[model samples]
Target: MGEEAAHRVHSRLDVLLAERGMTLVELSEKVGLSVVNLSVLKNDRAKAIRFSTLTAICDALGCAVGELLEVQGEP
Candidate 1:
């Protein structure tokens, strides 16, 4: 029950973008984030995300933080 029990964050950006018919490039331009950064988030490789960045993405995608991120347990 140490850091091992810490929740892992999972990103659902791909599904969300698909639902909105948006591409990563489009999202990047709209949210002012680089495609590489967005790709990291999309592929679940991002170690962390800034609150402002998350807010911007949410605003541009018309989604909530919960919709883009979810907590999961390590297997």
Candidate 2:
């Protein structure tokens, strides 16, 4: 499953939230996003994320874009 797995982008949202002692509910509220949207991202099912949303999330999490999103595969 090397190639298949490589194409998958895993979300570290859960880890970040836990590390910061924050919950998805809290993040969603702070970022002005719905829990469903955040949950999809957290579950690694989001097909795409807007730049604004990413910025807001990063800001709310006090993390950089690199810390939030990562390329899983070697290109």
Candidate 3:
């Protein structure tokens, strides 16, 4: 088999929120989640997210999943 490639992905919430002139508290309220939960997501510490939650975040932020998360090739 060919060598497997490894990649890492990071969150763009901080940047996107800044661009939109929003704060984590606002996002949390809009997304119907707690600040702590949103912080986890914003800091890339979340392991899983519900589809409904994802949809809510997308709706609130006016962004798609692709715009929020990006892939980084192995260093």
Candidate 4:
């Protein structure tokens, strides 16, 4: 079997939130996700995210998935 690729994915949730003048609590209410879960994502510590959650966040923030997540350069 081939080994999976190693890549670091980071979230721009904080930036987007700031740009939109929205708080994490507001986003949580809109997306129905807890602040702790969103914080993990915002801090780029989350290992996984559900498609539904992604869609909800995008919808709530009026951003595309590409705008929310970015792949970090090789380290």
Candidate 5:
């Protein structure tokens, strides 16, 4: 068998927020984050997220992190 390869995955935060009828601003307010920071996440431009921020987002969105992220083959 061929060796398995590692790959990077991405999130669909923008789409999810749209489906939930939520804007970045609104989510930011609810999650106690700045709109600018939320926009970075929404636009897939954030390099990393803190645990506290993740918890706040999950709590405000009523969703598990798994629902926000996915795995796929590397680019």
Candidate 6:
């Protein structure tokens, strides 16, 4: 696999936000997180996330962890 393919984990925050008709600013407020931090995750640029942060985001979005993140691989 190529180097890019090696990174299979992807964030689905954008999709979830869109489905809920929410914006990053709104999520930041609800989750008590900075917009900059959330943007990192939403754009899939974050290398890691704290459990508390994840839980907060999940609660705000009304989504499971699995729904917020996904693994994609070549068939």
Predicted model with the maximum lDDT: 4
The sequence of per-residue lDDT tens digits that candidate 6 reaches over residues 1-75 is 775557777899999999999999999999999999999998878878999999999999999999999988754
TM-score of 5: 0.77
Better of 1 and 4 by lDDT: 4
The residue pairs found clashing in candidate 5 are none
Better of 2 and 5 by TM-score: 2
Candidate 2 Cα lDDT to native:
0.88
Query: Which regions of candidate 3 are displaced past 4 Å?
Result: 1-7
Worst 10 residues of 6 by lDDT: 1-10
Give the clashing residue pairs of candidate 4, or none: none
lDDT of 1 by residue, 1-75 (tens): 564356388899999999999999999999888999999999888878999999999999999999999988655
lDDT of 3 by residue, 1-75 (tens): 332333256778899999999999999988889999988888877767888988898899999998888877656
> Where does candidate 5 have its weakest 10-residue lDDT segment?
1-10
Cα-based RMSD of the predictions, in order?
2.6, 2.9, 4.1, 3.3, 5.1, 2.1
Q: Model 6 misses residue 16 by how many Å?
A: 0.5
> Which 10-residue window of candidate 1 scores lowest in summed lDDT?
1-10
lDDT of 2 by residue, 1-75 (tens): 575565567778988999999999999999999999999998888888999999999999999988877777556
Question: Tens digit of lDDT per residue, candidate 5, span 1-59?
Answer: 33334324466787778789998888987987889888777766666788888778878
TM-score of each: 0.87, 0.84, 0.83, 0.89, 0.77, 0.87
Ranking by lDDT: 4, 6, 1, 2, 3, 5
Candidate 1 stretches with Cα past 4 Å from truth are: 1-7
After superposing all C-alphas onto the true structure, candidate 2 shows an RMSD in angstroms of 2.9
User: Would you list the clashing residue pairs of candidate 1?
Assistant: none
In model 3, the Cα lDDT at residue 49 comes to 80
